[model samples]
Target: MQTRSLWEHTLTFFPQFLAALKEHAPRDATVAVIGASDGKFVLPLAAAGYRVIAVERDPLALHGGEVHLPGTAHAHATGLIDRLRLEDLYDRVQVVEQDFLGSEPLDRLCDAVWTSCSWHYSVNHRRPLAEFVARMQLLVRADGLFGAEFMMPVEARHHLVDHYTSPEKLSRHFTGAWNVLLTLRTAEFTERAHHGRLQDHTHRMGLLLAARTSDHPHPHGKKNA
Candidate 1:
């Protein structure tokens, strides 16, 4: 049986990032996905022959279980592991079940790193946005790709939080040894009701793709004089 994610059809800018990775990184590059929910992006990367590091803390999303549907109903869901196993791609992935910020640094640098609207959740708001970006940056090797598509402010409350930010605002985190490749933002648009969103809603999203330059300095941004 084919498996699907709750966000199967959600709008995303990940394709642009993947294309960029293909052009810049090697065919067997190792990738680290920060919010790899049920393998939305992970599966495709693994299918394309890229080694993947899937970082997610939600048990239901990573391990599979019952999930509430639109109405008063629930259904069995296929988690990341099951989907990978079924596709014969389990050997290409490493699952890290932990809060990214709380977890220790990744063991080794990756050729590319990507995250999608992961840090905007309330639970992550406690940590500064810079911290999240810096951590992701730290995981990429020199000349590696770093991609992120994030939520832009839509509601009054969203404006109050730094997480609901535009691509321009997020770009401030990259400098010195980093080169901004592309940045995109979508105007507020309506989206069909999904799992957490029970009613039609409007949202603005942004994407930022950058590369750690070949002469990349320390992750902390200190360069040789």
Candidate 2:
């Protein structure tokens, strides 16, 4: 049986991003997945012949372990690494176990980078949204793809946090050497209860796909024109 992620059923714009990546990046390109949970996106990238860097911090999410299921149920869930091995894709993926924000720079720049609804978690809110975006951006090589699907403001509290943002607002960060390729947003929608969230909830999501047009120095490092 194919191993599935806890978020397998969640709505996402990842398919669109993947299609774009295939068009822009070479078949053998290296792609990095930020907050890669249980190999959802990582597996597909690897299976498509792309070398993947899977960055995830949660032990249970990275390596197999028993866990509580939806309600009053428990199961031994297959984690990202085991899943990759199961499908013979392990060789194509390098699992990096660390908190993405606090982790040191990746060993090498990637041809493309993607993150899905990762930075909106309560734990991540402590850091400014710009930090999360800048970190993801830094991982991409020049002329590479940068894709992120984020939670837009839904709850009253969400409105107060900049991390819960729309595509238009998020696009501001992709200036200078970056070119915005696509921006998409979803209307408020209901999602069924899942592992971590045991109650059904409503959410709005936004996707921003951009490409680095040139290798420009970091804003702070740039010399005066």
Q: Give a tens-digit lDDT track for model 1, residues 1-225.
A: 267778897899999999999998999999999989899999999999999999999998898898776774778889999998998999999999999999897878888999999999998988999999999998888888999999999999999999999888998998898999999999999988777787788989999999999885555543211
Highest lDDT scorer: 1
Each model's Cα RMSD:
3.2, 3.5
Model 1, residue 67: what's the lDDT? 79
Error of 2 at 77 (Å): 1.0
**Which lDDT tens digits does candidate 2 get at residues 117-142?**
99998889889999999988888877
Off by over 4 Å in 1: 220-225
- Residue 144, candidate 2: C-alpha displacement in angstroms: 0.2
TM-score of every candidate relative to the true structure: 0.95, 0.93
